[model samples]
Target: MASPPPHALIIPYPAQGHVIPLMELAHAMVDRGFIVTFVNSEFNHARVVAAMSPSSSPGNNGVGGLDRIRLVAVPDGMEPGEDRNNLVRLTILMTEFMAPAVEELIHRSGEEDGEEKITCMVTDYNVGTWAVDVARRTGIRSAAVWPASAAVMATLLSFNKLIEDDIIDAEHGSAMGKETFKLSPEMPEMQSAHLAWNCVGDHDQQATLFKYLVKGVLAVDQCEFFICNSFHAAEPGAFSLFPKLLPIGPLLTGERGGDKAVGHLWQPEDAECISWLDAQPEPGSVVYVAFGSFTMFDRRQFQELALGLELCGRPFLWVVRPDIGYGKVHDYPDGFLDRVVGESGGTGRGKLVSWAPQQRVLAHPSVGCFVSHCGWNSTMEGVRNGVPFLAWPYFADQFVNQVYISDVWKVGLKAVKDEEAGVITKEHIADRVEVLMGDAGIRERVEELKKAAHESIQDGGSSHGNFDKFVEAMKQA
Candidate 1:
């Protein structure tokens, strides 16, 4: 009889953004005949299962090649009703507690028979090296997966080096009296004050997160392979700087084979938004706006946004999470919803859903420009589809991504906020949308990038070759 397929354990940091890409990676692995143990925190596992289509069972089985992926849940070391949004707390709980839980899992998995014994572990890089330690203690191979842009990982990896050079504050990794700077001349420039960790919380919180970031740097020394969800053509400077970062992604579901990706972490309102997109005008007519899972805004900012969309006088699709304002209710400007939704169905003005199947929405023909919070997956999707962007960076590595989208790629424009109100005004939004949609040069540039993204994933192309190499390495394990 033929040998059974290799078993691989995959774990992601417990956040919607982090889980989704790794789930894509899991799908990619299953496509290659690897049976996977897909791990989620107890909290997220429930959320993921709940969000899945009704026919999908909670664990152990899936459709298509996904049948090989077994869903497993471990506690996040967080209690029910605790704040999962606290980055520093999550990091501490994950590193200190999750390591032991995963170690126990590895041991039990090895006790299995035949090829069902796990050959390897692939974990989110942001989880620090604790997951790596689990693999080490259990005597199997492990690979660190960076779900964000290669540029962001480069920044994280370079934090200590920047500290040693005194280019940034050693204690905090912030800029030394500068607004923005690049790690190297050829790379994109980023705000020093907006260092990824600095965007999360106050001084104490920033310091705590930075400490874990330092541990993440140490993770590089302990981990085996460092895989990134980016393509070489997408960020040549980042690949050139960090040769160790294997570029096997921009891993869209359309590019992969198998069941739909396993991580939604929320119910996807795909039917409504997609049907709405179909009814819209021709290519490049509708504006697509989403701030991703975590970007939140206050009442004033929300009203300003609604008013801005109305003022654009263009068709739009907006995804608004229920808890977007963190349990606080928001009231739109007078007649805002009536204007958009009432006329939207008839004239293709506006459609709002709590959550959307983002990849499918971006792939739609009518999506002309993206008004985004600059999350890497959304950034990659927009780039892949050749859509222009109005970059609205909220925090963390998103600021750096905005730089790449606007300054480096030249395919998007940044939505500059008012200094006085500290919010992007309605007029600013409407005007930027008009400029972005009307810019011939921006459209042409994004078209070229879209072609690059396409070519890289084809046979013997850069990404294809890299994925083949990674698969081969796993086979060796």
Candidate 2:
């Protein structure tokens, strides 16, 4: 008798944030007895290999001995040496390039083993429509993975009505920045300013992103299962919005263990941050700060944030990437580093690096609070680590994630956005950080939510149960 199919193809969106959660989910599938093939763009595949330590190899089964998980690369259709200065062009290329690459992977997987065809596809929600096309063409099951909180997805779905009512336009014009609007009756707490600004960029760009989003949402209707990186209890209102949505989150389980799992698109994670964290005074005594990969801050704003950290008088680990501004290297204002060092009495309680091992840093006992951009991956990591948040939303679903963190879960406090100046002052930042860290009542409230977040992802918890159901459904499909 012939053997059963031996592989599953997992395709995630190319960004670091999107890839990490999908990688965790793929690991879960591997643990449950499946051959996993994680596909990445060629550029990303090289990065992942470069990032891995000898011990971190995928295993005999492929790079560290993940045993069942294999990494594969597909072309992303960019020219060999294209300029990446234009965000609009990059976005367009990502959408257009991926479809053919994914289709080619399906064809190649089918040819590898006659009986071991591509049984199913696990893909990011943004890639949903393409996955659907591949599934239809190849006769395989496809599932959509929403690597975002349920609340954010619900908010995106509401844009259709905003467009219908002429409150928002499918194309950008003078009307794009006219006034803020509310999302839906269900999400009355969300304001129009919180919706993705990409929706209001140049007309063609706006239409392209909206088109991709709409197609992804509609493709969910055809998926065998819809997976969300969220816990049901974390966003009850939004959880109720989707018929097929499955919550399987706080995805960074077993983080403290030494097991090496490959992330979606990998870069050489700076492990030096771990040693710096260890040298801190005590557990839960330091603040961890990071804006997700794509967030860029102007020079003045970056200085204010640095000054705010100093003014708060807290030990901190801040990750400031080179591309944080419109320059190659981040240059702080004069004497900023000197001021912070002097405030710490020359012991350098503050450590700033371009990148860090985020999971390990979050899980570190010394981390007491997180000042984050409210990206979904970071939010889940914070919740899982039982840390409270100081939310500074930048773009995309970040604003919606902030709503869940501050308004819904009550585990976070939002940074005030300045309408006229378009910048937050150091004083405002210092005040909020102090309130979140020093107030006993606020600390207690944050801890309560942290406990609840932990419970939601534990065995027999809502997220855990949903994960099992999702896997079972995939088996049946």
lDDT of 2 by residue, 250-345 (tens): 788323236353562334455677887888878888888898777778877887788888888888888777552532333666676666654442
Report, for all candidates in order, the number of backbone clashes: 0, 9
In model 2, the clashing pairs are 57-63, 57-64, 58-63, 58-64, 58-65, 58-66, 59-63, 59-64, 59-65
lDDT of 1 by residue, 342-451 (tens): 74543438788777778888888999999999998889989988999999988788988998899888999999989998899999999999999899999999999999
After best superposition, candidate 1 residue 419: deviation in angstroms? 0.9
**What is the model-wide C-alpha lDDT for candidate 2?**
0.72
**Model 2 stretches astray by more than 4 angstroms:** 1-6, 57-67, 81-91, 94-96, 113-115, 164-166, 170-188, 197-203, 253-261, 264-266, 324-330, 339-347, 418-422
Worst lDDT run of 10 residues, candidate 2, spans 253-262
Instruction: List pairs with backbone clashes in candidate 1.
Output: none
- Number of clashing residue pairs, candidate 2: 9
